[model samples]
Structures are given as structure tokens and as C-alpha cells.
Target: MERKCNNLPFLLLMQTSKVIHNQIKEEMAKNKLGITEFSV
Candidate 1:
């Protein structure tokens, strides 16, 4: 239904954010950057 369709993007965004966040963390650790810098 319409509700289920709307939920798809939200779920996708959450999944994508998790992946990006982890990737950023890895990159920050590799270069020794702070959480604030990685967030920005």
C-alpha cells in the first residue's frame, strides 16, 4: 500500500547511512581524524 511504499525510502536511507558512517569511521581512523571532523 501507500504506507509500505513510503517506508521503503526511510529504510533505504537508514541502511545507506549506516554504511556511510562506518566508511567514514574507517577513513578517519586511517588518517587519525576526530569524530567532529568526520561528522562534518
Candidate 2:
């Protein structure tokens, strides 16, 4: 339990980073779709 507690912050940071990255990827994909539609 002590070891897990020590690593809790790092684990939370990684999880938050993954969430932000995924959101950014989704937004980029949406913008790309708009660009493609405009070109067509």
C-alpha cells in the first residue's frame, strides 16, 4: 500500500495526459474532415 500511494501522482498524470492527447487527436480529425469537405 505504501508503494502504491507513492506512485499515485505519476499514475494520475499519465492518465490525464492520455485523455488530453485523445481529445486533441479527435479535434484534429474533425478539422481535417472539414477541410476535405471544403476541397470537394
Q: Which candidate's lDDT is highest?
A: 1
Q: Which 10 residues in a row give candidate 1 its minimum summed lDDT?
A: 1-10
Cα lDDT of model 2 by residue, 1-40, tens digit: 3545468888999999999978867876877755456457
Indicate the residue-level lDDT of 11 in model 1.
Answer: 94
Prediction 2 TM-score vs. true: 0.65
Question: Where does candidate 1 stray beyond 4 Å?
Answer: 1-6, 36-40
1-40 per-residue lDDT for model 1 (tens digits): 3545568888999999999989988899999989888667
Model 2, total clashes: 0
Candidate 2, poorest ten consecutive residues by summed lDDT = 31-40
Q: Rate residue 20 of model 1 by lDDT.
A: 96
Clash pairs (backbone) in predicted model 1: none
Residue 22 of model 1 has an lDDT of: 92
Model 2 misplaced regions, further than 4 Å:
1-6, 33-40
Cα lDDT listed for each candidate: 0.87, 0.76
